[model samples]
Target chain A: MTLFDYIADRWDRLALQSWLHVSEVVQSTLLAAVLGVLIGVAVYRSPVGSAVATGLASTILTIPSFALLGLLIPVFGLGPTPAVVALVLYALLPITRNTIVGLAGVDPAVTDAAKGIGMGRLAVLTRVELRLAWPAILAGMRVATQMLMGIAVIAAYAKGPGLGGEVFSGLTRAGSANATNQALAGTLGVVVLALLLEGVYFFIARFTVSRGIRG
Target chain B: MSDVDVTGLSSEPGLKRADRVRLLAQPLAVLVVVGAVLVWAFARETDEIEAESIQAGVLLTKTWEHLLITVVVTAIVVGVAVPLGAMLTRRWAKPVAPVFLGIANIGQAAPALGVLVLFFLWTGWEGLWAAALPIAFYSLLPVLRNTIVGIQSVDPSLVDAARGIGMSPRSVLLRVEMPLALPMVLAGIRTSLVLAVGTATLAFFVNGGGLGELVDTGYKLNRPAVLVVGAVLAVGLALVVDWLGALAEQLLGPKGLG
Candidate 1:
């Protein structure tokens, strides 16, 4: 069967998998961003703290995703839990590092000006520093999201949601009718979704970046 | 897979305290963690199935296969990407450089596992070449990109000076541009190395036997010891390789550049 015909035949199931794939990745990216930004905030003030935080996060990145899944399977059991945990861990480095880099990149003079204007420390941070650092933090999120897309595919090994199942099922059914189509659909679906997310991020940056700082 | 320097190897150029600590501590940590895991796995009681997969001979062979795939893939990536990147940076090749990078960016977006399985299906091939080929494609972007960026970032005035001194273009490229670009190229290679090692774990999916096979075997057969051993060993190997890459970056770059 032609690839187009194959996709058409399984359009509903393919659509659901695509949604689940994006959903899982988006949720994981958001979760990592929250945790990463907090870590970045906590550590950015101290050089040593920033180094340690980024160091540990990058070490996690070095671990192969499959191995990490294997390590987690025993602890988290199969399904989305292990998958999500692995995705979050993988996403942390970029977000946290960027958060640190972004926050640190903010000019001390700007913070001092806010202080001189009678803003409290919390107000200075929330109103000024974070706004200025939003672009870098968003860039980090962008990187993490792109990365988690591929990883969520691997997470399918643990019976995690999304297009990865199609790839694995296709692998198992190799040499059979429609196997190639199945794998191609899954693979291409991810690439397409990743591109789509890239657009989403573009719009997000457009709308969310403070007007004065938009680039 | 656009090969971000996830490991932060290039984040700080000089030997800061953190770099020194990591340089001394990473391999030591790998040794301790991997050794402890191996000892625990062997010391534990096991069923026949677990014992079969967890034997020293079996573990060693699997680790060897995993390293072999990583090495082969890294070699192919460096060989292909370095020259390709260098060519793309040439004045005549500039117009098409983005085209190559665009293709690579899309390739990077395609999942590594997808790339591997698709390659296996397309070629009807298996074993090392099957695994190595697709992975090389997946990991090539980093080195290729860095090579172009490295060469392009060279100061034009430096090139002008070399030309004014009667140096040939080829010699200028060899002695001037390349040495200056070495650190970036090496940093890119390190990222590719880590990627190749990580992706090599999936080689077993294509019958290219590696540490991942043990992972699959353990997962399939319900043997946590086997699974942990496989996972830990793969993790350990990647750390060691990354550490080695960092060391090379520190030692191999041309002097006086830092």
Candidate 2:
């Protein structure tokens, strides 16, 4: 049978796998964004806190994905819990860094004026600083989404829900007839998902960034 | 001046001793712990598998294989990407740069494993080149982009001055542009080096020998100790490479620039 034929045969299963991948990515991305932004906010006031936060996030990148999953396996067992945890950890650096950057880029003069007008610190942050920094924060989210998309494939190593299982099994069984097709579908799903997420991010940027800034 | 500016200005460039200790000590502690674990695993494993001389050499073989892929991939990526990036920045070739970059973006967008798997399936074989080729493809983007950005960001006045001093266009590019671009280009290479180190472990999946074999065996045999050791070594190697890269970047950059 042709590759498409095999794909057609496996459509339901593939769709379910694709859904799992997307859901996990969404769950992990949201969690990372919330946690990252909070951490960024907490640390943005102090240079030491900022440096430590950034340093810690970046250090997470040094761990190999394969080994990370393997290490987690003993503790978390074979499932999405460990997979999501790893994804969140990997996603933290970009989002946190971006949040810090965005918040930092807010003009001190603007905040001063807001303060002069009797706006409280919390009010200034919510109404002005974060508003101004929204674009950069969103950019970070976009990057995190893209990265997590690629990483979600590795999540399948821990049997986390995703299209990676198909890819992994097909890869190991490359000598078989339909193995390439299976792998192709899985890989194609991943790439397509990445592109689609990127498109969503573009649309988001267009609508969300202040019109003056866009100009 | 505002209170914030006053406070910020009060801190000297020289880090406090406490800050220095915190900066160096934390990562060093992690390294020490990781090292202790690996040594323990190696010693224990030796006692368990003493009969197999080849088995004993797993550490040596894996490290060697890991280095081979890292070196070959880094060489190929640097060789191709640096020149291609330079070529793209030329006046006539500027328009085509994005097209090439877009292609690179797609390569990066795809999972590294997916790229490797494709290459392996296409070649119907697995070994050094089979793995290295795809990794090079995946890693080419950062260096290429950095080189272009670096060249373009070179001070126009400096180029004009070179011309003013009777340097040929070729000389201007060779002497002025490249030297100035060195830091950014090196930064890009550093990024790729870290990437190559992490990705090289995946080489085991494609039948390319590396420390990943130890990882895989450890996983399959339920030996968490070996798995942890294999992983720590790979990660440790990445950190070491990153440090070395930073050193190179600092030293290789134009003297006054740093």
Fnat scores for every prediction: 0.65, 0.36
**Interface C-alpha RMSD after superposing true interface residues, each candidate, one decimal:** 3.3, 8.4
What is the DockQ for all candidates, taken in turn? 0.60, 0.35
Model 1 TM: 0.97
Task: Indicate which candidate wins on lDDT.
Answer: 1
Query: For every candidate structure, what is the RMSD over all alpha carbons to the true structure, in angstroms?
Result: 1.8, 5.2
Candidate 2, residues B142-170, lDDT tens digits: the string is: 88988998999999999899999999978
Q: Per-model TM-score of chain A alone?
A: 0.99, 0.95
Please, what is the TM-score per model?
Answer: 0.97, 0.91
* A109: Cα error in model 2, Å: 1.4
Reference-based TM-score, model 2: 0.91
Q: Taking the tens digit of each residue's C-alpha lDDT, what string does model 1 give over B197-254?
A: 9999999999999999999899999888899999999999999998999899889989
